[model samples]
Target chain A: MSAAPPVIDRLRARIGTPGPPTTAVVEAGHLKAFAEAIGDSYPRWLTEAPPTFLVALAPVTAHLPEAEEYGKGWLNGGNRFEYLEPVKVGDAITAIGKLVDVYEKTGSSGNLLFIIFETEYFNRHGRTVARLRGTAIRR
Target chain B: MNIEPGHELPDLIKHPTTRQLVQYAGAQGDFYEIHYDQEFARSVGLPGVILHGLLKAAFLGQLVTDWLGERGTLKSFEVSYRGIDVPGRPYRCRGRVTSVVGGRAELEVWGEDPEGNRTTVGTAVVELTA
Candidate 1:
C-alpha cells in the first residue's frame, strides 16, 4: 500500500494558482467592535479603525475553501503589512488575495507545509489602502 | 514623557486561548477557522487553534503607543512572523529604543513565549510631542 502524500502535496492540489477575489466592505461597527474587543482604547482606534485593521478586512489564505478542507493541523505562521493611509469609519473596502508560494519542510514535529498569500486592500474610491503578506503552516 | 535612545518598554503578556482567538476573529472580522476551530486547525496539521498575526502585532504596537502616551502618533510599523503563537502559551511583547531623532523615535519590538521562543519581530516609528 502507498503512504499518504505530504501536507504540501495536499495543499498544492487544493490551492491552485488563485481564484476569484473575495472582498468585504469596512463598516464603522466592525471597527468599533474590533477596537473594543482588543481592548484598544486609543482614540485613533476607538474613534475609528486604523489602516492596519484592514488586515482583518483583507482576504486571507484561511478563507480559501481548501483551507477548511485542509483540516485542523494548520497554524498562523506570520504576517507583514504596509499601511498607506489611515482607515476611517464607513469606508467601503475591497480585498484581493492570491497564492504566492507553497513548500514543505521537516521539523521536530514532522512534516509541515508553508503557504504564503498576498492580499491587497482598496477603499471605496478604488484607492490602494494597504498590502499584506500572510503565511500559514500545515503540519 | 521622555524616551531616550536604547530605552526599553515594559513587556505585556498575551495569554492566547481558543476563546480569545474566537473573540479576536469576531472583533477583527476574521472568521477563518484556523483561529477558532481546533479540528480544522488539526486538519491543516496544526496542534491547535492559534492566535492571529495582526493580534500579535497589535500587542507590540500597543506597547509603543502606551509608552508614547496619548499625544503621540504611530507613523509606521512593520514586523515579520517568526514563529507560531500557540494557544495557551504565555507570550510577552517587548521593545527597546533604537533611535531618537528630531522628536521621532524608533524601536525594535518582538514577542516571545515564556520559553523564550520568539513569535513576532518588528520595528515601529513614532512621532512624539508635548
Candidate 2:
C-alpha cells in the first residue's frame, strides 16, 4: 500500500463540513457509570441526574470518518457547553454535529491543525438540552 | 445551604496511568487507539498514551461535585484542552468560585500536571439545592 498523506492536510481539506445527527436512548446504567467514573456522588447526578452528564452522550453524535482515519493524531483541544435544561434517565436524546472551521498555526512544538466542531443536544420533547463546541488539534 | 461567591472547592489529585486510560476508553466507548496502544500512539506522533479530553473534563466535574456535596447539580461546563496529559504523570484538579448570581454559582477550574503545566482550563456553573 502507498504511504498515507499528512492527516492534518486531509482533515483541513474537509473543513466546513457538517456531519449528520445521532440519536440514542439514555439509560440509567450509562448515567450511573458516568457518575461513578467521575466520582460524582451528587444526589442530583445520582438520583435526579445532572445536566452536564449530557456530554457523556457526545460520541453517539454523528460518526466522524476522519476520527477513525486519523486515530491518535487527533487530540481533544477543548470544548464549551451551554446547558439549557437538565437530562433525566430514559430520555431519548438527539445530537447534531457540524465542522465549523479548520486552520493551521505555528506553535512552539511545531504546526498544528485546529478542527472545530459544534454539537447541539435535544431532548425527547425537542427542547434544546445542551450545546457543545469542541476543538481538536492534530500535529 | 447556599455557596457564596468566592467559595472554593477541595482539590482532587489523580495519578493518571495506562490502567485508568484503558478503563476510561471502555467506560466512555471511545476506542481511540491513542488512548491505549502505545505503538499506535507513537505512529500518530504522540509521546505515549494520553488521557482522553472527556476524562479530564470529567475530573473537573468531580471537583465541582465533590465540593457541592450530594445535593448539587452541574448545570453546564466549558473547557479548553491546553496540553497533553501523559499517563504515569500526576495531575490535580482544582476549582474556585468566580461568581454567584441568582442562586447559581460559577467556578473557574483547571487541571495541572506535576510539572505545573496547565493541561485543561475551563469554567463550570453549578446549582446547589437540597
Candidate 3:
C-alpha cells in the first residue's frame, strides 16, 4: 500500500534553508489599491502600508510542489506579524523565507499536514522592517 | 487613547463579497483558486470560493488602527484562522485591551461570523506615544 516517501519527511529535509530573496519597491498605486480592496479608506493608507500589507509584497507560504500531493485542499491555519518599522510607499523591500518545521496531526476529520514557515523583510538600508510567521495546512 | 486594561476598541464589521475576494486575490498576488474560482475551489474540496486569511487579518488590522488612530503604533499582530468563512456573510472584528503597562498595551482580537462564533482569533501589541 506504500508508494513513496511521505511528503513531510521530504519537506523536513530542507528546514533552515531560505529560498531566493524577492525584492520589491512599495508603490503608492499598489497601496491605494490594497487599501481599496480591503475597503479600508483611511487617508493614512494613501502613503503608508496597512498592517497586513507585507504579505502583499511577498507570499506568506513558499510554493512546495511535493506538498500539493498530500492534501485535496489547503487551509491557512494562522499568521503572526511583527513590525519593526513603518512600511511606507517607495521603500524598496526584500523578503527571504524558509520552512521552519513540518509535522502531521490527526484531527477530527482526518490527518492534517502542517507546514510552518517564516519570512524576514528588509528595507534598502538593510534594516529589518518586519517578520512574518505562517501556518499552512493540508487535509 | 484611553487604553485601560478593559478598554474595548470600537468594532469593525466587513461585508466581503466574491468580487472583493477576487480583488484581494489580485492585490495580494495569491491566485489560489480556493479563494476565487468556484469550480476549482470545489474540486479542491472547499465548499466554494472562500475568503483569504490575510483578508480577514486586514479586517482585524483595520479594527485596531481605527481605534488607536494616532495614539500609538502596532508592534506585533497575530491571528489564527480557526474556521472557514464565506464571502457573503458579515465578518465582525472586535478586540479589547488585555493589559496596559507604561507605553505598551496588549489586546485580544477576533473576527466573528454572524453566528457569533469567533472564527479568527488572535492578539496585538501597540506602543503608545508619551
Q: What is the C-alpha lDDT profile of model 3 across B1-130, one tens digit per residue?
A: 4779998888899999999999998889899889988899889777899999999999999999999899999999999999989999999999999999989999999999999999999999999999
Task: For model 2 chain A, give the 10-residue run with minimal summed lDDT.
Answer: A60-69
DockQ for each of the predicted structures, in order? 0.45, 0.50, 0.91
Candidate 1, A6-112: lDDT as tens digits: 54566667454555656776676777777655656777775455535766675566455454444345566766666666677767777777777887778786766
Which of the numbered candidates is closest to the native, going by highest lDDT? 3
lDDT of 3: 0.94
* Candidate 2 local lDDT, A12-123, one digit each (tens): 6666665667788778888777666655556666544453466667663345556445433677888777877766777788887877776778878677777787888888
Measured with C-alpha atoms, the lDDT of residue B33 in candidate 2 is 94
Greater-lDDT candidate between 2 and 3: 3
Indicate the TM-score of model 1: 0.75
Cα lDDT of model 2 by residue, B69-90, tens digit: 6565677788988888888887
Ranking by TM-score: 3, 2, 1
**Model 2 interface CAPRI class:** medium
Predicted candidate 3 versus true structure: per-residue lDDT over A15-107, tens digit per residue = 889999999999999999999999999999999999999999987788798999897888999999999999999999999999999999999
Candidate 1: share of reference interface contacts reproduced: 0.51
